[model samples]
Target: MNTEVIWTFLSTQGADFALKVLGALAAWVVGRWLIGIVVALIGRALEAGKRVDATLIQYLKSIISVLLTLVLVLAILDIFGVHTTSFAALFAGAGLAIGAAWSGMLGNFAAGVFLQVLRPYKVGDFISAAGVTGTVKELGLFATTIVTPDNVLTVVGNNKVIADTIQNYSAEPYRRVDCVAKVANSVDAQDAIARLRPAIAAIPNVRTTPAPDIEILQFTPEGPLLCVRPYTHTDHYWQVYFDTHKAIVATFGAAGYPVPETPVAHRMVAAG
Candidate 1:
């Protein structure tokens, strides 16, 4: 090409190219500032929710920032006359592959969100879930940490817990502690019942509203099983269980009733 033709092309097209580059740069600067503002607003809104947990708020902020950035990048690419629909398809394919690979992790994340929203069991609540019974120490995004009854720390996946039963002992205000005391069938039934019921009621921490029940259960191999049931606050369940049994032994001993020398399985709860 001749020098004049080259000069003419540069003067027209080069100036337009430089203006477009400047415009894209300006858009980038404004877009980044807008993203920051939007992210801050979103964080404040989430904080205002009060129910939204801190961990979840942070995760949402990250997601919003990434989405806004992707949109901004696409806008800039459009300004430069580049194809963006192909990028969207590429991202969709990549996302599908990642989702398939991390399906378990995704399930855990969704379960965590549901847990926070539902508030089924909170920290310090005693819960039995997925065959592990313990006090819930912590609930995380993917798993839960519980201190077992034996004082061992157990981390269970969130997905596994909801998949099974969740029994919240702390949900109720009161719990019943049933203790069975079996003596010889020869013992006086009415007298034993009369002595046992009052003795159980007198124990401290036992609730008086429900009174107390001392009924003669069906005769067992050992003897007549007296079902001593007492009510107490849920927190004092274990304490009441132990103390009432002691009261039973003392009550029967003072009355000169024959007490077994060996450890008897008198504390068995009936399976429903």
Candidate 2:
């Protein structure tokens, strides 16, 4: 081919390539802005629902925006005569490998959705699950945040928690607290029970409607084993339990009840 002819062809092709590049860039910018507007509208709709968490809504909106933008980019590439089928196949192959590697993560994501839908637990609720007890801080797509009684932050996988039994202490408005107290076998069981009722009732946050009760659980070799059952508001259960225990000990001591002790035989007479 002649040099002049080659140069003329190259110039025309360069101008065409530049036009396509500009068009693709313009399409991408417009597409992104459109996606943003749609996502904002979706967020507003979710907010209007007033039943969903605002943070969750915003997260969903961002996810949707990214997906929409991806689709627009693929469309723009196709408009520029770029083949995307090969890209789709590559993505599918990669997705399969990723799915296998992240099977546990997928389970957690599914469990998180189940938890949200079922509403098994909520923020600020004290729950024991997967062998850990703490107050719920936040429920996320893969993990749940819990704050321990000592104020330590614990991140638990949602799948593990869902797989295990969940004990929600604050599920109900009231809770029953059981405490054990030992008294001397010489002390009258009936008298001990009577003393517990009045002492427990005097503690603040101890519910009187259901009434507290003390039962002789067993007769140990050392002394009588008593169990006290008191009902209190869920929030006050721990407070009442501690206070009632203190009150019972004080009342028993003041009343001169013999403290329970293990028996020790000082001497054994031998049979001759």
State model 2's lDDT: 0.85
Query: How do the residues 1-272 of candidate 2 rate in per-residue lDDT, one tens digit apiece?
Result: 59888788778787887788898999988988888889989888877866556667776887898779778878888977989998788878988999999999989988986776577889989899998898999988789999988899999999999999999999988888999888887898889889788888888988887888779988887688999988998788778889978988898988899988766641222221
Tell me the deviation in Å of residue 240 in model 1.
1.7
Model 2 TM-score, all chains together: 0.73
Model 1, residue pairs in steric clash: none
Estimate the lDDT of model 1. Answer: 0.86
lDDT of 1 by residue, 111-160 (tens): 88777667789898989998999999998888889999899999998898
Local error of candidate 2 at residue 138 (angstroms): 3.7
lDDT of 1 at 145: 93
Instruction: Please name the candidate that would achieve the greatest lDDT relative to the true structure.
Output: 1
Worst 10 residues of 2 by lDDT: 263-272
List where candidate 1 sits over 4 angstroms from the true fold: 1-10, 14-19, 22-45, 259-272
